[model samples]
Target chain A: MSITVRIPTVLRSATGGAATISATGSTIGEILAQLASDHPGVQPQLFNEDGTLHKFLNVYVNDDDVRYLGGLQAPVADGDEVTLLPAVAGGFA
Target chain B: MLTLTSEQRDAMVAHCIRNLPNEGCGLLVGSDDGVISQVVPSANVADSARVYEIEPKVLLRTFRAADDSGEVVAGCFHSHTHSDAYPSPTDIAQAPDPSWHYVLVSLRVTPPVLRSYRIVDGDVTEETVTIR
Candidate 1:
C-alpha cells in the first residue's frame, strides 16, 4: 500500500525542507523506514538508539493516533496520510 | 457522603477557576481504545491581558508526557473567561497545531459554559462536551 507522510515544520529541515512526502508500506514502521531512506537525515531525528519512535513524537494515521491503534506496527492502506507531529516547546511572549 | 468517580472532571473545573487570571492552559492524555483524557483550561486573560500569550513550552512538556504514556495530541484547550466559550479570531490566527481540539471553558460567572471544538484551518466545529 502507498501512504503519504507529513513532516511537521520543526522537522522539515531534516527532510530538505519538504513538509510532505510519499512512500509505500504496509505498516507505520515500514513507511517511516522508507521516509528516512528518502530523507537520509531524518532517521536520527525521528528514531532513538533502539530505532523506536521518540518519546516526544506523535504520529496519526488519518485522524486516529497510531499509539492507540498499534504503534509502529499500525497498518496503513493505500492513500493513508501519516502526520508526524512533535511537541512544540517555544513560548509566546 | 455518596459519590461517583467524577473527581477528575471536577478537578479540571477547579483548575480552570483558580487559573482564571492568566489564561491557564493544560493538556490531557491517556485512556486506551476510544481516545479520551482530553485537555482544557479556563483563561484569566482578561480584557486588559490580550497582549499576553500562552507558553508553548508548557504545552510541549504536556504533549511529551502524553506521548511518553502513549497518548495522541487528542486536543488543545484554552479558556474564554472574558468572552463566550468559542474560538475568537485571534485564536484562529494564533492556532499552531491543526490536529487537536481547542476546548474552551468559559467562566463568565453569570453563566458558565464549557465547550469543546476542533479548530482546523481556521474552522471551528463544536464537539459534544458532557460534564461527566
Candidate 2:
C-alpha cells in the first residue's frame, strides 16, 4: 500500500530536499520500517538509542495521533497518510 | 477568550521543554471549552527569527481531524526556546484566522511559563492559561 509521510522542516535534511515521501506498507510499524529502510538518515531523527521515538517527536496515522490510538502499531491502508512531527521550541527574538 | 485546563497546560509545557535548543512547535486541538484533548507537536519552520508556521499538511490534518472529532479549532501552541513568552512582529503579521488562541510556551526560563493570547491586526491581549 502506498502512503505519504510528511517531513517537518527540521527533519528535511535527512530526506534530502524532499518535503514528503511515499512508501508502501500494510501496518503502521511496517510503514515506519519501510520509511527507515528507504531513508537511512531518518532513523536517528525519528528514533533514539532505545529504538523508540524521541519523546519530543510524535507520529500520527492520518493525524489521529498514534499515542491516543495504538502508537507505532496503529494500522494504515493504501492512500493513508502519516505525519511525523517533532515538538518545536523557539520564538520571537 | 479561552482558558486551558491544568492537564492541557502541563502537557503543552512538557512537550515544549523536552525539545530544548531547537524551536519546538505544535498544534493544539479541542475547543476553547475542551482545551486539553489534543496536543500534537509540529516543526519549527527551521528559522529561529520568524514566527512558527504549522506544516501545511500537518496543519490541515490537525484542524480537519479536530473538526471531525466534533471539537472546535481552539488555538495553536508553540514554544520560545530562548525568549520570553510573547508574540513577535512576525507573529502579529502572520496571525491566521483570528479566533485561535496563540499560545506561547516559554522554555528559556526556569520553572517554564505559558501565556495565551489573541493577536489581530496588531493588538495583543494576554489570556489566563489554565486547566480544570
Model 2 TM-score, 2 decimals: 0.55
> Model 1, stretches more than 4 Å misplaced?
A1-93, B1-6, B31-34, B38-48
lDDT agreement of model 2 with the native:
0.70
lDDT digits (tens) for residues A1-93 of candidate 2: 689988765567778879789988777778777877888887876677787665556677875777666766788888998887654322454
Candidate 1 lDDT tens digits, A1-93: 668887875568788888689889999999999998888887876788899986556677877767777889999999998888664211122
True lDDT of residue B123, candidate 2: 93
- Report the C-alpha displacement of residue A1, candidate 1, in angstroms: 35
* Candidate 1: C-alpha RMSD after superposition: 12.4
Q: What is the lDDT of residue B89 in candidate 2?
A: 72
Writing each residue's lDDT as its tens digit, candidate 2 over B1-132 gives 556567777887886766566666777777656355777777655544344556545765765587578785566888877778898776665555356678887777888888888876679888766555
Q: How many backbone overlaps does candidate 2 show?
A: 13
Q: Pick the candidate with the highest TM-score.
A: 2
